[model samples]
Target: MAFVTTFSTSLRSGEGSSICGSRPLSRPSQRKMVRIFMAQEEQLKRAEDRMKKTVETVKSNFNTVRTGRANASMLDRVVVPYYEVDTPLNQLASISIPSSTTIQIDPYDKSVLGDIERSLMEADLGMNPNSDGSVIRLIVPPLTQERRKEFVKSVKAIAEHGRVAVRNIRRDAIDKYKKAEKDGDMSKDESKTNQDLAQKLTDKYVKTIDGLASEKEKDILKV
Candidate 1:
């Protein structure tokens, strides 16, 4: 009888300390906290990745938006007349902008000299090509009023494309947040907060695109 009572007293003392464990991390409450933190971190990483992709997309589309200044992208889509085959101007020749309104192209194949010049004139860049059998030069003329208006239209189209990209990013981020909530990794309230933050980021990027468009329009309008 004495042994049984002694064993019961020892069991009670062990249970009290083991259940309370001195370190908070060893407690069930703390385990839940750690799980919540991990879930939040995962969600944050996903959101950050989405934002990065959105930024890159914005940059790429912005380049295509066109500025009044000379830029490689301005000729990125220009095709050269290569010996009966169409080729990107960049591949067929070296294009250089010696001045604000001049672009020089030196073709690798001398035989296609005339063809390159013809293609440039056909590019509708509002410039004439000056060639001397080896190299071709393009003189970018000052934009006319009607030409500026047309360029503005092109700018608007590019801006709309950027807007679509930003909206797509927002949609993807929101979908991720919803998935996190469905997986029990996030509460509804937390998901809502993250979605709102993501939307704000989207707005910022959209504004950046708009600003680029405005600057480009002003430059194109400048005489």
Candidate 2:
């Protein structure tokens, strides 16, 4: 198929002539360009989505780590034995943060309170559970200076993991962009531009993860 058809003769009245030493691109070429643009945009969008998910994971992890205050999400990993099968504590009971330092767990069945208490103790959350046969209470003790430092380190590690995830997404996007160039679907210049854009996006997300970790670190370090 002809990508460009030059006019060898001058225009006849209504016949359009190639303007500025250039002819209009053929329909097939225009469609191909559109497809390439769409594909590049899709890769960029996928990279952004991956970065968002990684950041969300980091945020969730920050909530799970111990703080000066009690959080319901801290018990996200707590599982109790219910009828021989391990079940999530939230599924078997209602968890409430009644105060800054207290987490209340009230079992729906009432009979499983003991099991829930046991799970809380064995979970190694560094907090003891008090059960008075009906409701279980977890009084989150104040974090020691040393423990707060430990928490800061832990949250920093999680933030690093998120940054790595964002970088991995960038790598995947660059790979797709390079393949598109190799397959003749896009030009080398297009591939390079996409790679640069992906890198910028990765840097932006990594900075966001760092900021999140820094905020959590401050919270942990605060007296």
Candidate 3:
């Protein structure tokens, strides 16, 4: 009975050691998988961030296009020469839309009013600046059919550029993973999976850009 009990005890000890040995072996592989996943996630996040920025840029550009109504954002691109340094128009003045078709600019410093007026004139926004010494007024005229069509075309071009930028970011992200696979940092299957994810992200952002463009086009075409 004693010998039989000793044999059973040895068997249980062997089993426990085997399990412990396997734990050490698996730990490295588990850690490696975690690292790989984190790297892929980081890459995807970076790509998405860039795509979002591109969309925002397209939105900002669309805002700069003149509509029939008075929008303060239409002067977003205007730069005034303040003390020999070029500055954004919004920084130098308080712009208000008191009416549907008039943009009023009130400068804190009256001395810079003339500079602001000249800058607005040079902006070529199809509006003349009427400055009465302390303030500048821009009368946003109703856009003709031809002018509206032109603005629509411009917004379309901007949307296309944004789409192209998103696609470029996707390509760059895919290339990074492919190179990782080539360097044996990841498997081909992993690289392919990441590439597919990048494509999906691109498609989503491109769709968003299209939507923004459609909205801008409608705004420009509205009488």
Candidate 4:
């Protein structure tokens, strides 16, 4: 009976040692998993930021497209040679909508009035700039059917570029995870999950670009 008790005690001690040994091994693995998760989150954040900027760029480009109405934003792309430096027209002038069909540009420096008018003429906006000494006036014309179709095509192209940019960002993020999995920094399952997330993000931004494009198309064809 004493031998039996001694054997039983030895078995219990062995079990306790085994449990304690497993704790140290598990701790390192748990910390490694946490690190991997944080790294993936950071990558996703960067991808989202880039996608947002792409969306904003699409919006800005859309603003530059002409509609039937007069919008000051249409001149957002006009650059004038001021003091031998190419400068944005908005920086050298005060642009205001005195009427729905008129865009008045009053240059802070009267010397650059001619330069602003010349830039507007060369901007391919299909409008003539009328300079009256100190200010330039632009008469916004009604867009014909053919012109409206052309503007629609332009906005569509802009949206396509934005979608491509977003997809590229997603691809880059997924590639990072693939490299991580290859290097054994993360598991295959984790890498796949991150790639799926990046795809979902890409889809969301692409939908946003489409919406913006559709809205601008409607505006152009509204006349």
Which lDDT value does model 2 have at 118?
Answer: 86
lDDT of 2: 0.85
Rank by TM-score, descending? 4, 3, 2, 1
Error of 3 at 99 (Å): 0.5
Worst 10 residues of 4 by lDDT: 11-20
| lDDT per residue as tens, model 1, 39-137 | 555555566566567656655555554445665556666786565677887898887888876777888877777777777667676667898777877
Q: Estimate each model's TM-score.
A: 0.69, 0.85, 0.86, 0.87
Q: What is model 3's C-alpha RMSD?
A: 9.9
lDDT string for model 3 (1-223, tens) is 3433453354444432233355532444544545666677789899999999999999999999988899999999999999999999999999999999999999988999989999999999999999888899999999999999999999989999999999999999999999999988888988998899999999999999999999989988887
Return whichever of 1 and 4 wins on TM-score.
Answer: 4
**Residue 81 in candidate 3, Cα distance off native in Å:** 0.9
lDDT for position 192 in model 1: 93
Evaluation by lDDT, superior candidate among 1 and 3: 3
Candidate 2 off by > 4 Å: 1-25, 83-85
